[model samples]
Target: MNFFGTIFSYIRETYVDRLSYFPSNIKISLMIILFCAIAIVELYIYIIFRRVIKANQNKQTKYWKERIGNMLASVVVYDESENTAEIAVHFYDKLKKLPLKNSTVNQILTSEIITYHKNFTGKIPEVLALLYAKLKLDKRSKKKIDSKHWETKIEGIREANEMGISEMAEEIIKYTDDENGLLRMEAQAAYLKLSNKDPFHFLDRAQERILDWHQLVLFEIITKNKKLTIPSFSKWLRSPNDTVVMFCLKLIDHFMQFDAAEEVQRLLKHHNTRIVKKSIEIIGKLELEELEKHMFEIYFDHTDEIKLEILNSLGKISSGKYADFLSSRIHSNDSKIKRAALYAIKRDADHGEARLLEIYHHTSPENQALITHVLDNRIKQ
Candidate 1:
């Protein structure tokens, strides 16, 4: 053993001495090559480790999904018993015994349950809600609502809302005042879902501009719930937040709350151009003849956008009484105004075609072209 050790030491010393004699550049180059080799080995090991982890995760996901899918299928197909509540309890008991109740498994169950919950309504969804609550997934989601991560909290709110966890409404409402816009929107949607007693409660105090996408979502949710006691949207028409007022206008238009026609007429003279424009649209839709004079009164006090909207409203109203205003605009130097006037006139074919022919004989070429386009292109069926 001593002889072998001595031979090894001698060889290593000889190698080190030879390396020490190498020029500085060659030594650096060799050191770089050594480091590169080490990095490549480490990277290869890391890649292999990641692939192994991914494969294991995929295997576990498949296992849990299969188990959960079987449970869901049994609920929908195999369980012929009309008593879904009892079956939901029994299935939840079985679900609790499944192996590996980790985050991944929980996520899979959540996604699966949400898919079924959205597809069905009435007692079916109610039973699934019981299953979700019994599985303690609702508790997990509630815990996530308090998570330090914003996205996690949003996901928690969404899960609670989608699963119909009404108990979490107060907890969800706390985030409605969050600084993050997406988080705030999600929280509001959750609140709307869980708290149907007063769905638009947050809108009363909302400070931000409710985006168009958010409006569409809330509209769908509110409109679909037949049991909901929809309050008077006119209460929000005077909101200090323009977005709230704007959203209220849409609600009014959609519900066709003719009682709010008085308020809608008053808003036509609002200083905000959007409020005025939307008011015009709602007026036209409701066909509140009393509101026509308000639009005509404010016609010259607003911008071109408001002007076009007013003309559009006049066209929609299609009453012969607004013909004088359209006739006046037909002679204006602004071609857009002329087109709007022509459109308004063309809309009133019963009373305005004679005036259209009479104007064609005396108007500017631009006005005549516009008249010709309207009379030809906007033909009545």
Candidate 2:
């Protein structure tokens, strides 16, 4: 106490005594500045301390992950009988011995298990699923699914799907039409994986537009899973949502559902020209020659874009029956329609080349050039 009193007396004599000579306002300002400087220094030190603590935590997490990963690897490679229960117990025991809080350890363990599950197949995935349940890690994911936060909900949906938690299907399906696009996409994917009965039942009730990327993901999931039953997409051709109807059209073309020809013919007269165009394309690809006459009837009533699609569809059909309709469009003011018409005429297997030559001399220079291009086998379309 005497040492501190001597230091305080010296500091007061050296600094505080000198400040008394200055004006009172200046003195108060100096004191305020001094306190602020001290505060800034203390805050800097606090930040450094926090960074040090975070670094140590990261190191500990990495060490625990490596240890957990090795244990999981051992469980995956056990070539003995399919005794997942015994294996799960042993795995859980090893994880419990780790020197970390249960929540932290479980987080790292869950992540590592999912990584392994994504890479493996057959019995290994089954064993990993068993381990995930035995440790009660699924509860964490389920809770996240119930989170008000959308990002957390997406993570939970992904985890449940990867872990094969089929019982979560009912809860997950509700998010399939979520206002959030990403969450809706993840939920849709999870439903496809988890549900066995009426896997595509969501389509019947989906109100939001299923974007192109979403469709791609769903298509990949469906095609890769051999056991997944392909639904009759023609059922949704009359859907109120135009995008849904378009997606169904793509699926119909892909699966070659010939029975959908009647339904597809109906869409050609639908109000949305985009859907009508898609319907025309599908009709051509499926070689629905019966619908060719209906396409001819609507060809004059639509825009050039739709007109171009009809011409292209006629080329695909190449039934030679639409030669008169193809030739009538050869004089169209739009160059695209003219070229499409010429190409369709050239595609006809019967008398198409001869028909092109017959109209060559009488047509305009631009039409002649297009015809020449179509006729020349060396020119790639």
Candidate 3:
């Protein structure tokens, strides 16, 4: 108190007393500058204090990670035996004896166990799952899932999915169509990972448009998990949602679900050009020779984009029946359509190159150059 009093008295005598002689404006300016300086000083102290606290937290987290990692390592490597339940119980007893009651400690423990679970398989994962339930980390995850914040819900869903908390599948499935796109994506992924019965049940009921990137993420998840039963995407082909139909087409193409070929053939006449174009492309890739006539029927009435896809598909089909149809389009006004036609003609193995040579001299110089480019072995379109 005496030190503070001395400092206050010195400031009063040194500046405040001198400021009284200055004009009112000058006094106000000086006061403003003094307050600004004090604020800057306080801000600097606050920043330094926060840094110290963060550094302390990082140090503590590192220590706990190492300790928990070592303990989990013992559980995984030293206890690989037939009696996994007994081993899990022993590990749970060991963990309870530690300082895991603290939330911070529990978080670290959860993270470390999840990391282990991801890196191992077989009985190891089963043991970790048991230990997770024993430690009540699932309850923590459940609380986060039920939180009002979307970010917290995502974190909870991710933790539960990663930890293989199968019981949380029902809770996570509720968010599959969340208004928040990211939360919906996470919940859908969790449902895929956790749900054993009808894992893709969300697709049949999804009302919202699944974004393109979200589709890619879901596709990757489905393809990578071999255990996941690949459903016949054809069932969704008749969906009212165009995006769902588009995604189902892609899946059918990838999985080579020839069973869906009939449904795909029916879509060639659909009003949506995007869907029609994809249907044509898939039919070509699948080499459904029967649909070639349908593609030819729809070729002239559609836009240049659809024409280009049809031409490309014909090239992939490489059936000699469309050689004349492909050759006729070589004179199309649209340069893209013309090139697509030339490529298709060259790709048609039955007398396609001969057809190109036959038209080379009769066509315009630009058409001749396109034909030459298509025929050139060095350029791989």
Clashing residue pairs for model 1: none
* TM-score of each model, in listed order: 0.79, 0.86, 0.80
Q: Count the backbone clashes (under 3 Å) in each candidate.
A: 0, 0, 0
The numbered model that scores best in TM-score is: 2
Off by more than 4 A, model 1: 1-59, 99-101, 119-124, 318-321, 346-350, 357-373, 376-381
- The whole-model lDDT of each prediction reads 0.83, 0.86, 0.88
Candidates 1 and 3 compared by TM-score, better number: 3
lDDT tens digits, residues 181-272, model 2? 99999999999898877778878878898999898898888778887899889899988988789888888888899999999999999999
Evaluation by TM-score, superior candidate among 2 and 3:
2
lDDT sort, best first: 3, 2, 1
- By TM-score, how accurate is candidate 1? 0.79
Worst 10 residues of 1 by lDDT: 73-82
Q: Which stretches of candidate 3 lie over 4 Å from their true place?
A: 1-67, 79-82, 99-101, 121-123, 269-272, 361-366
Error of 2 at 72 (Å): 1.3
Give the Å error, residue 124, model 3: 3.3
